[model samples]
Target chain A: MRVRTESILPYSLLAPTLIFITLLIVVPIFQAFLLAFQTADGEFTLTQFEKMIADTSFADALKFTFLLLIFIVPAQVVLALVMALLIHTRFKGHTFFLYIYALPLAISDLAAGIVWLAIFTERGFLNSGLFQLGLLERPFLFLSYQNLPALFSTLIIAESWRATAIVMVILLAGLQVIPRDYFEAADVFGANTLKRTLFVVLPLLRPSLQNALIIRTIFAFQTFAVVLALAGRVIPVLTGEAYNWYALNRNANIAAAYSTLVLIFTVIATVVYFRLLRTSTAEAGFD
Target chain B: MAGIQFQSIRKIFGKTLAANDVSLEIKDGEFMVLLGPSGCGKTTLLRCLAGLERVDGGRVLIGARDVTELAPRDRKIAMVFQSYAVFPHLTVFDNIAFGLQMQSRPRDEIKRRVEDGARLLELSDYLARYPAQLSGGQRQRVAVARAIVMQAAVLLMDEPLSNLDALLRLQMRAELKRLHQEIKATTIYVTHDQVEALSLGDRIAVMQNGRIVQCDAPMNIYDYPANKFVGGFIGTPPMNFLPGVVRVNEGKPIAAVGESHIAPSVALASALIEKNGQPILLGIRPENLALASAQHANTIRARVLVVEPLGSHKLLTVQVGAEISKVSVAPDQRVAPNDDVWLHFDPEKIRWMDAATGDAIHPG
Candidate 1:
């Protein structure tokens, strides 16, 4: 029944974060749920849900978001792993490469979108450089509304370039902590590079891999700024659609409904990631 | 089994010479210990033999095959690292069987070999446990088991017991020696601990400054070190060196330390008579020096500084003129600080060395 000051001190220290999270994060989620379900007259209604289902761009938004996830996430994972390994080799200018790779992590998603937009836009640097090099006879409209595939590919490249660094940074940290002795031991036992990576490095890096995968997958489902910057209204992503519904059309109800859908998708994707990349408590660390 | 030969291998790291033209030949089935202090290139030389590091010069051979260009696996070798490096995620069974699996051995054969290795290292019960679940000694056994399970012609160990506690290090040292006996694989064990080298090595190669100073049987290396560094590096209290000049007193060849004439051993006496009036070093072990009841012909007066009672025996720190030396005596001997005593040297146990070069001056 006795409470000590030392025991209560840690809880007091954590009180601010707990209070802020409830007010800023938990309260808003509930607020979003209420706005999504209720009407302007304050009556419980399925009208917002009906409109969300019927809107033609709603299907396109879902398709575009899932398309981006399918192409972008795996590509980012592979590219990041290769980049991390290259840096891990510590050959000559590895520190320089690490700095360059992690440079994108400091840039916001919107800034990254605008930077890539400059490259892939019609008459942009990409087209001008290609034309100058004689690779293209004239400037190409790569991200035009007509060229859906090219637009999608450019968007994929931009997103992958911007996001892959996060995974690489995580994996590089993991790689650095893996003791050099493991690789040497594998070498002494006659394992080739591929076998060593698979049997030793990959297994030891499981916890970091799971972390990077879960974090990237959640961000993939909620991708918004880069798509809006590159293709504008041409690419109908779910988050872009939500923003348009709320800002341009002034319909907070339908926007909240769209947000709810994105929330559902991200939660499901995050759960799937957790299930797939599960690490046992023992495998999670080596202390 | 495979004999290893390092043909004047040179490994330079940045500006430092890690292995400077180091050449050593290890006979098949011999447990060779590369013993040295840190940064002495003992580990570097072993790594060169393992093909972990490319030699900037010379060649390496295992058995009859030139393995300098071969990969570690292709060289047919196994190594136990100082950190154990057992796969943290895998069970003991999987970690032991990893090399065999990489070589694509049959499932049953891999299982059998792993089981045999576990039995040998007494890790049969811990096969189901992960490395993180085991103690430090257990993890070391896992590393050893993994290495021996390969049945390679050559085995290399880099201070495998260095990470364990003192008691565990002693226990693991015995286990390694026992395992080497059961499987007579050519092993190159690297350690800075002289006790490990003396107890486990068939031959000890004492290294310093990236070169092998002496390579001989453990006792020989202890009794007759190649140089002062080797003499100082080995032994607990170490060999005591007395600076003196060879002189003929009345017809007897004796070594004059300052104003006192101490008789040299029979072998050292013969080696000294030819070169009279030449400076030489008399290297004698601490246990070889005893206290004399009175001043005798071969006795030197020493002032005791500290008398430390070490269980079964007593170690006396005594100053003989300009030289400070340790003398081990029986526990019952009555000696104290500031006690002046006459010390006697057993002539048969004395070793003579060149004062300038510090090399052994062998009897002709």
Candidate 2:
């Protein structure tokens, strides 16, 4: 068969992306797998995994990571859904509210972390405000290692404030595609607001919920910048342990093991989300 | 089960007046159709009745109870939307049972009602299917079934047939009439379609801008339209209108044409005698005017412009002086374009409209 110029043109156009992915992404991931399984002399061994399991913060990292994932994902999803629905109502000055809600999307994770850190630190705005309000005689240490739950909560709030906008945007798109007649039908059929939200709105929003869940969960699994900036070593996460192993201790193999574990968790999370928020092709707008 | 009254209803949407002091009474089991073109407030009026729209001022009564301040869910009304808003995620049975479930009815009663509704809508076989699995007509049936299962006091439909194809629309229109006959719910249906209004409405309420122009039975609305706008809006191959003068010729009231004049009957002359040489609009339906064999006292000369051969009849577009008029003629009528013709007025069928206000003036 003769290769047609038209077909050749398509592959030529695709070459740049294919080459870039193979070199930058595919090659690095392959090297990470190899490094995770190799010893210092480049010989294959299980020593990295053994070392990763033996590390003091490894179990803490996994537990805290799961804790953050369990708490933050639901908080962001609920918050974003509410914001999206409120915006969809098109009330007076809804555009202004939408703008305010999406403003944090442009913020870097580190920037958001630092910003929240200032508010949660001992002499930060929250403690200062509490002192001024006569609720506290002095600044309170809200981000101390003595209280892990407090530290965990600050991480969840800061992360949610930074990341919920993307999910809301996805949900807003989903909401817009839903015809206004459905809500009117619900009202006419005597479905109250809560019932309508539970039955009509949520069912229609499955594809978006699926997407938001997978993306946010994967982001939770891989997140390190915000965690480090806010909680540091006190609330050690998987990615932070990986970072500490690779950059501080100069151990790429152990870091690769931690990273490989993060990948596994992300894959598991994505699969779980796909199962939980499953939408038929019909509901996903295919038919 | 109950009647509806919109007592001096007024609704304002931002700067646009959607319903301007619209007051109407709909009897129990009466199928009242609010008929008008888009932006004429027909749908707005229906929404206000269904409690979907808030009236800035006025009261809405379902039977004797005032429901103007009620929420839509509390209004005891069910509606079928134009888009056939069947819950896409739900099975046909579940969709139909939604309202019954909302009412917290017994499970068995909900099942019985849904099954009955499905059978009524011919959706019994597709109870397990989702809306996406059904055709447009079937989905609309699901919407109808959903409404019917509730058995509310009032059933409001907002252009429900508008989304269907032409053949499906015709099919649904007949089915809706049949359903109304069987159920006898006090229904308020809104549409821009005149045929639906004429066929389905017990009383057709023709609206314009934000006011009801006329409300009457279908035939009465078609045969005796209250205004020129109502007449024109409700018919095809519309009423022929000529701007002419009512003059007294030989002491008899005659409408002056280009050079000739057509005199009214002896009965009509008595009514027009009071106002001589008054400018009036002479209106007649195409079917009411005939091609005269020769020029007579009741005939005006014209030239045939176009002869469109319809299956049942030939429609002749003729030029009368500077004005054009449509005349429905026998299909075998030997008339060609540019042929000279004389139009004979059916004196009894002529409608005289006020030249300025467009209101019907039944002279005699």
Best by TM-score: 2
lDDT (Cα, tens digit) per residue for candidate 2, span B269-305: 7778776878888888899889987987678899999
| lDDT of model 1 at position A132 | 91
Inter-residue clash pairs, candidate 1: none
Q: Can you write out model 1's per-residue Cα lDDT over B48-95, one digit (the tens) per residue?
A: 988889999989999999999988879899999988899888999999
Please, what is the whole-model Cα lDDT of each candidate in the order they appear?
0.90, 0.90
Q: List ranges where model 1 is wrong by over 4 Å.
A: A1-51, A128-141, A282-287, B250-252, B273-279, B334-338
Interface DockQ of candidate 1 = 0.51
lDDT of prediction 2: 0.90
Runs in model 2 lying further than 4 Å from the true structure: A1-31, A37-47, A281-287, B265-271
